[model samples]
Target: MSKSLLNHILLLVLLFIGIILSLSLGSVSIPFKEIIKSLLALSVENSTWDYIIVNYRLPKTITAILIGSGLAVSGLLMQTLFRNPLAGPYVLGLSSGASLGVAFLIMGAGLLSGILGEFIFSKWAIILAASGGSLLVMLAVLSTAQRVKDTMTLLIIGLMVASLTSAVVSVLAYFSNSDDLQLYIFWSFGSLGNLSWQEVGILASCWFIGLGFAIFCLKNLNALLLGENYAKSMGVELKSNRILIIVSTSILAGSATAFAGPIAFVGLAVPHLVRQLIPTNDHRILLPSVILGGAILMLICDVIAQLPGNENTLPINAVTSIFGAPVVIWLLLRKRKLNF
Candidate 1:
């Protein structure tokens, strides 16, 4: 096999190892043998260990993989569309917009009861509210993208929307009850543990749809990298392609934020890592690698968030920022600056 193919295989193997390790490592540690046994019995019988493994750890692990892959794909799409390596889901303020949506539900609607509520948001109402908020922002951004011709202008507008959303969230927080405020604060910190199986299913479905759409647009993305006029010269319809990319990115980023509460750095950093590994700009290769790289990074971050030594788990966002920020800085300082 070529070195590149060999490396990809190695990475996939490592990712599988990471998933298994994540399943085994937690507050209540289970032996590998028991974990394997539990999986075998999952369909045939019900046991205490089976419930724990299937209901709890399985969902968390699946979420980590899904969110990681979704965010990474979103980042790649944005970076390609903007022709800016630094353009990530978070950088464009999509996460913040999602946060703002959740904030409104947590603060204004007082809907904090249900599966997530027991540990976190704790309510279906909050989840719905947050989803609504994110959808609204997605629509707004999509509308703006339709009107604006310049990619940089769209980015600036996104930033402005994010800032406006943050300002609103601040005002809401200022007036919110202390109990609600604390919940909001924790939600903002981000966690994979917040998702239940139903939520995981929703996330998985959305991710699959978004990824499928992204794969279909690979050729257009490649054409885009050559510049808008060049793409047009090649008979690539800019308007429709742009809309599809924006919509796909919005679904991926929005779902992740609504569910995971804006886990940081995975979307922004993983694509660059994949690019470095592959040493090619081809989206066909880069897209799949980005997904795998994202899943691996998120699994690692989820393990760190649990932190076996500590009674208190670190927030998912905190762990991501600790690793993500440095990579982002390096990308910014690289020889070829992102023009968009």
Candidate 2:
């Protein structure tokens, strides 16, 4: 086999090993045999081991995989659309938009309860609100994308919108009661442990839809990498392609943020990591590699968050930022001459 194909095979094997290691290395360590038994849906030799693997470890691992794939794909799409290596869903404020929605839900819950007189705000309600908030911001960005000819200007506008959302969230936090404030603070820290099975299903559905759309646009993305005029000459409709990218990216990024509370850096760093590993900009290979790479990185991070040394888990966002920020800095330094 060619070297490139061999490298890909090796990477896949490493990723599989990473997943298995992550599943087995938590505080209540389960043996590799137990993990395999759990995966096969067999009754583990130890019943408690079965619960740990099946209930806690499995869900956490799956969540990391899903969120990682979603964020990485979102990042890749953003980078291609803007032709900026540093572009990511978080940088464009999709996560901030989701954060705004969640903030509103937390602050407004008391008002909602007072108004409805004994009706509690369900998890579904918060999720819907967060999705709505993200959708609104995305629509605004999409509208702005049509009006602005400069890609850099659109990126700046996204940042501005993100700042505006943050300002609004601050105002909400100021007026919020202590209970709500504490809850909001915890949510903002980002955790995979927060997901219910239903929420996971929602995130997964949105991720698949977004990923499918992105896959459809791979040719256009590849063409655009050569620049807009060149893409136009190749019959790639720039406006339609941009719209498709925006929609897909918003859904993928927004859903992850809404459910997981604005986990950071996966989108921005995972694509670059994948490209470095594969040494190709070809979207066909790059896209899937980035997706798998993201899943592996996230699973590893989630395992770290559990922190075997302590009973308490670290925030998922904090762990990602620790890894992601340096990648962003290196990209910036490497491309110092390139314009955003």
| Residue-level lDDT tens digits of model 2 in 117-215 | 533356666677778888989989999888887777888899899999999999999999999999888888887765766667788899889998999
How far residue 288's Cα lies from its native spot in candidate 2, in Å, is: 1.1
Whole-model lDDT, candidate 2?
A: 0.82
What TM-score would each prediction reach against the true structure? 0.90, 0.91
Query: CA lDDT of 51 in candidate 2?
Result: 83
Per-residue C-alpha lDDT of model 1 across residues 103-158, encoded as one tens digit per residue = 87778755544434454445565566567777887888888878988878988988
| Model 1 steric clash pairs | 113-122, 113-123, 114-122, 116-122, 117-122
